[model samples]
Target: MNTTNSIQQALFHRFDREQWAELRQSVPLTLSETELVDLQGMNEQLSLAEVTDIYLPLSRLLNLIIDAKQQRSFVLNQFLDHKVDHSPYIISISGSVAVGKSTTARILQTLLQRWPQHPKVDLVTTDGFLYPLADLKRKGLMKRKGFPESYDKKMLSQFIADVKAGHDEVLAPLYSHVTYDRRHDEHQPIRQPDILILEGLNVLQTDADTLVESRKPFVSDFVDFSIYVDAEESLLKEWYMQRFLQFRQGAFANPKSYFNHYSKLTDAEANAIAANIWDTINGPNLKLNILPTRERADLILTKGANHLMDKVLLKK
Candidate 1:
């Protein structure tokens, strides 16, 4: 017997786009086209159809899960004869860079909030927890910016723990894409929300380097549900290249942008540079770290070359 194949078959129930879209039956499309456009990431093609077909059903499933968890908590509290503060349900979104994780997170947050059950949904990206540029440079980890070691994992984990502990307010650091660094002066306050969506490249990663006797907790440990956005390596590279070229004219053009030096490059030059960065940095990180965490996710959203989800794999 093939153990690996058997385990996979038992673990996930696969659905094609059409099949998955059918699950959206009776789930109202709460987002307008204008709101969807705002939620779209650079070089991403997010449409109302995509939201209706992919995200609506996902939101519905999440709503159901949240409701079930809340009910279970209520039952447990009643049995214990004590009133306990309801903890926010945490949903984690993890994927390779340029795989549209942020867009997915934003869309889910919007759709989930529209549900009267959990109207207070908050979105937080792990980018903010990344070590500051100066810290990365000092630690000689500049090139490995998105790698697991590049983050202040302790602080990130503590923040999630505090939120899960039902803290009244938890402040999360903010990151500036233009400056390519953590904003020291600015922080996002996560008031005790009904649901919290944490999005990042390595949110699903587990540290294997920790000592066996002194194992540390991972961010995924606190996540109630986790999603992994996926695409072929070639497609991801293409999307990254497109986004990089677009940024040259957009964010990179700003004098305050960390990548402002690349703004003046011609299309060919920009593409060449983008390819080099992908080859050296993002590509390796995806292959070495992010992709390995795919199986750890509760659901995997696989995308086609057209930048739309083509398949859904949900853990059974």
Candidate 2:
């Protein structure tokens, strides 16, 4: 079998229930509580064990690719008489909301950093590229927040292109979940790093409309590898609803919570509302716009009913 199939077979072969047990021995996790807290948006706290098992080997394998890519590019550059920085490899992680793409990105970032050659792995979510709620409202897209039309596609494309071009620094907007919007006045500047994992719902979009409107190269064109988190629609709906209720009881109870208004509802009420929203908005976006891009990914991590990855599909 090829390397791709070998990786898939290794992952799938270890997918028995409680497979994390076997994974733990191979990929020891040492994430501190603070690190987990920092990555909470992706449920990093809940999935650490699985992260060790699934992402560690994957990270090691990617480092090998990064090295090979650099060597190949160096040989080509020698032939053409040109020079370019061998900057970090980038991985794009995409999936429907609450499918745990964020966590996967964070875990992979942390794991890759543990490798000697890629000690400076960094993660940036696509949320920062989303238009602020205020902008969305003015554009009359408040009802369609989180949809493809709600992003500043031009800016997002430019950001990716700048990073790929090895700009001294690339700035990205910061988002405030409390305000449920972008913090326009503040930005985070990323210098070049050894590895960058860009994670988001629509990170894979490259439709003609986007190309025309953004007027820049598609982000995926820069990805060295990409992953799409896969799970049954029913399981995703359940996870989304459960996470909604959890957030309501925790974050939403805070006055600063953007979703504080929902804090007053009972769990049943929150579940119903979350389900309805998912069915109308998130589910449709995943089905119509996002999942079609699954074929563009280099690897897929498919979760079972227990919310564990049971099978991994690698593209040939």
Model 1 score (lDDT): 0.91
How close to the true structure is residue 248 of candidate 2, measured as C-alpha lDDT? 87
Listed in order, each prediction's TM-score against the native is 0.96, 0.85
- Best TM-score among the predictions, by candidate number: 1
- Lowest summed lDDT across 10 adjacent residues in model 2 is found at 12-21
Question: Evaluated with lDDT, which candidate comes out highest?
Answer: 1
Error of 1 at 98 (Å): 0.4
Q: Report the C-alpha displacement of residue 208, candidate 2, in angstroms.
A: 5.6
Cα lDDT, all candidates: 0.91, 0.77
Query: CA RMSD for every model?
Result: 1.8, 4.7
Clashing pairs in 1: none
Q: Write the per-residue lDDT of candidate 2 for residues 1-316, one digit (tens) a residue.
A: 9865465565533344344335334455667656766765633245565555566556656767887887887889899998767466888999988898877787778777877766887789889899888788899987677778888877988887778778889998988887888986898887898778899988787755343565456777778888899888998988888888888888788998888999999878898899999988889888877877766677778887656777666565
